[model samples]
Target: MRRLMSIVAILAVCGVIVSSVSLQHHYATSKTEYCDLGETFNCDIVNRSEYSSILGIPVALIGMLGYAAVAGLATVYRERRDTPALLLGGALAGFAFALYLTYIEGRVLGAWCILCLSSLALITSITPLSFVVWVRSRD
Candidate 1:
């Protein structure tokens, strides 16, 4: 179970890293057609929107750091039992943030970024798995 949880966490981390990098690329680019699939789906519109950043930092960069922290916590959980709790907490926070971003994309921006949706999916999956891992560790 522990191995499975670790593998899942690692995979989620990879997904987040890929999505974050792609989002960062889109954010840095001026071309709006990179991920513009249609009227409802457009990465450029979402990434370039005012909601894409928090204060002065890009949200994708924050996601990369958050996912990296989750990965690190999962990797070190074996040596430190309390790391599972931290991993679960981090995953939960990331999941919550992803939800907020999704809401912004849907309600405010009226556009969707594939990379952002993928990161949301990854974080959604990570949250449950992290919870399970933390619960099992407590047993």
Candidate 2:
């Protein structure tokens, strides 16, 4: 359980870091610039999204902060897997947010960034792993 949680946590944190860096790259090039890398690896839509920023902060930034908090919480209860209610809650929250962002990218944005999708995958993985960890803790 510890190893699984650690792996999940690492993946999720890497997702957050990558997303944040990508957003920062977009923000830097938002004006008269597009981080284009041919087709199927577009970051242009992410840069153009109206919802990409909230109160002057990038959405990716929010994701970074959120994932960081979740990681810390997971670590706090790392030894108490039997009562991992908080960790489960964190996983649920992360998974929901990731899925929502993925939907936004596919349906609303109409462009896909590999980094964002990877983040979504990480969150998705976390949800199931956390559940399994919680169950193992009980056993």
Clashing pairs in 1: none
Residue 27 C-alpha lDDT in model 2:
69
RMSD of 1: 1.8
Off by over 4 Å in 2: 30-35, 38-40, 80-83
lDDT of 1 by residue, 48-107 (tens): 888877997888888888888887777655558688788788888999999999999999
Which window of ten consecutive residues has the lowest lDDT sum in model 2?
31-40
As for candidate 2, its clashing pairs are none
Query: Top lDDT: which candidate number?
Result: 1
Supply candidate 2's per-residue lDDT for 99: 81
In candidate 1 the C-alpha lDDT for residue 134 amounts to 82
TM-score of each: 0.89, 0.80
